[model samples]
Target chain A: MNKNRLTERKILVTGGGAGIGQECVSKCLSEGATVAVLDRKLDKLEKNLEKDVSINSTVLVEVDISVGEQVCRGVKQAAQELGGLDGVVNSAGIDLVSEFDDMNWDDWSKVLDVNLTGAIHVCQQALPYLRLNRSSSIVNIASGAGLVPIQNRVAYCASKAGLIMASKSLAMDLASSDIRVNAVCPGAVDTDLFRQNIRDESDIEQVKSRYAMNRLGEVSEIADVVIFLLSDEASLITGSALAVDGGRVFH
Target chain B: MAGEFFIEFEQFVMKQRKVALVTGCANGIGRASALSLARSGMDLVLVDIEQEGLDVLRKNVIDLGSRSAVICGDCQDEHILDEVFEFAQRDFGAIDVLVNNLGRSAREHASSFLDSSPDTWSAVLDISLMTTLRVTHRAAPSMKRRGWGRIINMSSDTALIGDEGLADYAAAKSGLLGFTRVLARELGSYGITVNAICPGAIKTRAHDHLKPSILEKIKSTIPMNRVGEPEEVAGLVSFLSGDGASYITGQALAINGGRYML
Candidate 1:
């Protein structure tokens, strides 16, 4: 409820063009943080920010985070443009749903590359700059599939679970540097990516009924958690995997 | 910008004077949480076995300009839990936050699992786990009707890491985690978030009995190389009990100075 909680803080949000990433970008700007958005789709990023006056202060970088070289250069460029970096939200992720037996090596590797390695690239590049600031943080956007197995999502689940453990290991390694790392595991958010999975109106209703809340989560709900973990309010929280599901896995 | 969302959230919370009922408010994490919640603009209902401690905290809450109610009774007593909840609903109208901070690992009773008596197990479990079960059972219905509540249970890192001579304590605390997860699932639709906070080696009255050398040995094990303050744990409890943590449910957050990572 506090405005300007992240005042003067400069943060880079990956996948900032759409879905939960877009919500994080907007929320960060509203909380008074200078933002740099990295996404493969530069046009989508531009279109999302075009209506806001804060666009003047934002740094937009076209980057495919799955590529190591691009992430390294993009992070450096964003840092230079923003003067420095205080935190990062690795919200860029890709999920490919296929049965384990049917999935090819390329499909499995691609999901791991974008969802897990992409986050690693961002953290690796941002760590040096993040270490310079006090109370710096990194928030990785994992998913409920990471904590519990989801049918037909072997690659997605494996990558997210790995990402969650990676976050904990990084948190332990960076604790001495005052850099906190945490993960958010969201379940069934109503995003374009999520909508793409549903075939019909009845499918949507069926998915909604799986959760105890009898509804899907909004992107902003997950973004709210990202902002909180990045703020000074969560100084003591690190190596924690917070589930933002509407109680979908309880049953 | 999404500034309007936060403003609306602030207004929604400010529209009513929220009430928080905390157990084991005599000292340590409980006392710190009680004070923190009071400062966050919530009226307080403090429960503890020590009458003097409750009186002291009651005065502290009143000084913060928030209403205070004190119940001097053991949390393990079912009748005491019933009275506490009745008093809360009669006075506060609806319960908004519940902090189950009424558990401890007694040094005298802690021993090798094979040598420990049944009495020790019952005492430890009754105090740490059953008390949580008793109080949460009574407070949940009111919270469901209101459509918003925050329940924080205090667990220990011992349960996570499996320390020697703390088998019963670990079992009880571990049971709390299971309870927290199931309750979070059942209550998620009702707008009530259930979470457990696992703290490691915090400086509390419980630690006053330990020798300095033993404390130093404990500190060396932590990555931070220092024991945590009670306020650090309190800060987390306050954050979890606020509107910002609405999306976080069924989480077990550890504030243990990098001692354990899960």
Candidate 2:
């Protein structure tokens, strides 16, 4: 596919150090957007910049998105560095794998803070710059778990489900401002986070059987969807939770 | 410069030679959708009960430089639908797009739910829902073999809002939403996208028969303060059938100009 689909746009991607977030940053850059990456770690962001070999095209901000103050400052600084913002991809997220009985209050709160509230912080900080553009968009990287229940992931599922609703609410709130908000719900993608959840070959096979595609998704598959939602191609699309989960979730 | 770009794009699409089967293609949104797909360089298999309208649309499609096979018959007839698919296979080799635009509420029976007869319910369900199910069933296997297809079912805002006095119509159209969602899930692995378009108050021949005062009142109810053009809904159908909408499936998109939001 052509990479120049996002020409002349400026975008910020949170959780850009790894997994789906990292893929979004790379794809956005390739699609001809000057990008700002916010992540708790700077190593992957630096590597992405080095691979692109154009230092001026990207801004890397080291900050925890879960912290509201850090998110506000980092988003402002990145917007300043990129000159402005046309879109934001809230791909920053954390997952906790625990049954309801094993989960504590801190575990549940941590998941919600990073996945749901973190997205809210980024949207709040980026709204000013996003509104300046006539057709800006926000793509929240939610999960298939958000739409359907998965066993042993009570907190993770709750956080993502809340994020999906938050995405729709934001879409309605921002429609008058001309900023479209949508979510991409990916299922069992072969990312760092997904690999961490698999304990053996049997687990991989089991997960594969769950999808109609009979395999895990590539990070690029999910990233391509995020890029499409952020682009002008999806102009009429808002308040939509597009499932790029190989038919795992329907909505 | 724009003209030159359009010419170049048209040539590119013509080279692809996509094939589309559009039912109820004689007038209104169906005809507009057929023409829009032709503009996108798709050869069409047009079906409608009106022969004269089909001839006109066939001429127009030929003028657009796209081949068209016109069949004048009721789409709800299983034999007619079978013949449509057979003709598509014989001429176009495989159907790349299926636009299920054959549907209508029974105007004569537009009374309260309790006042409606079983015949009205059957007719509405047969015309609006069963036709979609039958056609999609026939076209799906060919689409699965080709590994790519776009199926767009025409539903209505009544399905979403459950408007009074149109209980039968609402039930039929609402059934389409559930059908589209399940079919999308079943066919996604085969690269076939199933989506429904829910339009409200589009200016069509059916509405021309309505009293002017009633039409005006309907327009007043719309937030856009005007009735929608058939071509407006056609634009969305064209988009849903195109490459840009590959990831979108099982969605019932509203094109009612803010009259309804989902």
Candidate 3:
């Protein structure tokens, strides 16, 4: 909890405008790293700093990651502004809530574009800077839904699953370059959006009962792991898909 | 060595400490885990068949500013294990954590299953799987009384991705995954978390004895293109025993340097 794990390192976190991504960015800053946030919206990350976080320590960049060209530009700008990059957390993703029969090509492709392709874009663009440092790590925010099927979300599942496998493949290709890549699979995080979206207390209980722990994980808990994977502590942990879920069933 | 490994509780009294009982702590992963746990501020009751290594480790733990007690004996003996837990209960009230580190990735031989005998299988199962069951059986009651405990089992990634000729070892270590899940379900409400770690080729004494050419071939098969260190696995052990891993249970976490994926 002391702020020295990532001292003087530079990190870029995609989808840092809200939820788990935002939390990773703030925690990275508090851990003595200069962090840059790339997302479509920057106001939330700018205004939503923790009491211990100083906005002066963060650089906010606005860009659509789904587009390769924009990601190329955004990553270059972030690395340039922060002087270099030592880590990247791909946390920007959207869930498409539709059955297989109800899904349209537009929705399916859009989900894949942002969740899977966008992650690839950021990794490709950040590669040059990532290799410049003594060590580098990439943590992709995947979902347990990717590992296990979740009904009513075919596109979301496929996209995240693709990201997890891609992360493993990338770890192999980049290990010689001294860059480590891994994925984090979270199950039903208690984010602000997740809390507001659940309709009733009974609904919450129903979800809780499904997990062995009978509760949802907090965003800070997820960030604690991401920070671990990014630090020197996890040097031997490349190509792992760590599940931060609260003892969800089957896994 | 001639008598009991236990020191009389009547001789010493101190404030309550977070005690972690790590079995097989004489060398390899077990020694590293005990030292790491002590570094994390946990008092230790170190168990192993050998006494010399445990004494060295106890001094290391004491130097780290944590209490360390040595219990040297074979864990397969239930009476010896019973005394370990009994002393832990009377001295520290109960062990807060247990690290089952008796499993060793066998380097005795790599003969095919056709050449393996059933007798060899039983010995492998006894040391890797049954020993952990005995220790857990003794440790669980006191943990349930306190409503919080952490149990970490050392499994191997070869258990998931079968090795060419390590069938018996694979079967025995893989059995740990099932045991972990069963205990997680039975102990969840009691606030105890049980999990297993499946590590790929770590540089233990076995690796040190291997020819450099053979070591290179093994490293080539892993994606990270290298073997892992004991201290690296120790870091993960430290995390799983902490409050941050409270919600995580029943998982066979692989610390392989990208050798295999589940």
Candidate 4:
């Protein structure tokens, strides 16, 4: 809690406006790293965190990650803002709850475009800056649904699963350059989105029962794991998928 | 390497110092893990087959401002393992973490597949997989009582790749991965997290036996074109033992510099 685990590091976090990505921004900044928050809604994040940290420590890059052109420019801007890049958190993703046969191509492809392709785009664009550093890490926010199938989430599952494999393969390809890549899967977390959606008493209980801990995880819990993976403490780790699920996958 | 992975971070605000027992604490990953845990403010119960390395590691732990107790004996010996547990109970009262670093089976003379007899296979299994089974079995009750525990088992990337001349080591490590998962499921309910660390081409003392040409070949095979350091593997262990890794379990975390991906 009192460690500067990522001291002097520069990090770029996608979807930093809310949820797990927002928490990662706060934690990384508190740990002595300057952060570039790439999001479509920077005003919301700025309002929430303006009081806790100096405005100088954070750089805002407004971009919708799904667009490759925006992502390319955003990655370059973020790298320039933070001086250089040491870490990246590909946390921008959307979950589509639709049956496979009922889903439209736009919806399905959008999910893949944002979650899987956008993440790869960010990594690909940031490669040169990342290579400039002595060591760097890329942590993609994959999900438990990625590794395990869930009903009514064909697109979500596929996108995350693809992101997981992409992360592993990227690690394999970039190991020679000392750029570490890994994916973190969060099972069920207590995000603002989940709080708004799972409102019924039965629905809440049903979700909790799925995990070994019989509860949902906090966004801060997932953020904690993400920062740990980004820091030097995990130097030996590469091409690994870390689960921050609170024992949800045990069954 | 394609393998089982595991890790745990501090889930609760620890008010008391945690105690960890590390087997094969004399050198390499074991020695580095003991030191890293010491640096994390955990008291250590260092175990190994020799007193010299344990003595030195104990001093290093003290230098890091932590307490340690060393026990010298082959952990594969049932009596030695018993003594280790009894000593911990008498002195430390509980072990919050266990590092299974010793991988030698009692009869492991020839590590190569064709040269290894049945005895060699069983010996490797007894030490790597069975010893961990016995120790975890012994440690789980205490962990359950406390509502938290961590177990780290050392596997090799060879277990995933089935590298030439290392079939017995691979089989034993593969078996350890399965045990890691089953226990991670069972003990997870009790707040115990189990995981395995698979290291590839580390420049440990054991590697000293490998010819320079062979070592160079191993390095070439790794995409990073280099061998890993003991401290690097220890860094993973240290992170797994922290509160941040609390949710990671039943995994085989490979630190091979991308030599193989599973």
Worst 10 residues of 1 chain A by lDDT: A242-251
A145-208: candidate 2 lDDT, tens digit per residue: 9998788999999989999889878877777677888888888888888888889999999987
**Alpha-carbon RMSD, candidate 3:** 4.6
Write candidate 4's Cα lDDT for B1-262 as tens digits.
1232222222232337899998888998899999999999898888898888888898899999887778899877779878888988877788999888888533326555766688777777777778877877887799989889998989888778988766677788998888888888777777777888889888787877878898988988887788889998998888888887777777777888778764
Candidate 2: residue A1 Cα off by (Å)? 3.1
Candidate 2: tens digits of C-alpha lDDT, residues B52-75: 999999999999999988889998
DockQ of 4: 0.47
Candidate No. with top DockQ: 3
What is candidate 1's lDDT per residue for B102-187, written digit by digit as tens? Answer: 99775766779999999889889999999999888888898899788999999988889998899889999999999988998889
Better of 1 and 2 by lDDT: 1
DockQ of the candidate models in sequence: 0.44, 0.16, 0.54, 0.47
Interface RMSD score of each model: 2.7, 4.1, 1.6, 2.5
Q: Which CAPRI category fits model 3?
A: medium
Model 4, position A37: C-alpha lDDT score: 90
Could you estimate the TM-score for every candidate? 0.91, 0.82, 0.94, 0.93
* lDDT of every model, 2 decimals: 0.87, 0.84, 0.85, 0.84
**Which docking class does model 4 fall in?**
acceptable
Candidate 4 deviant stretches above 4 angstroms = A196-199, A248-251, B1-15, B105-108
Give every collision pair in model 1: none
Model 3 lDDT per residue over B1-262, tens place: 3233334442243434578999898898888989889988888998999889988998899899988767888999988887787777676777889999896544575568899878777788899999999899888888888888999999999998998888888998899999998898788778888889988999888779989998999999887788999999988888889876777777888888888865
> Residue B8 of model 3: what lDDT?
41
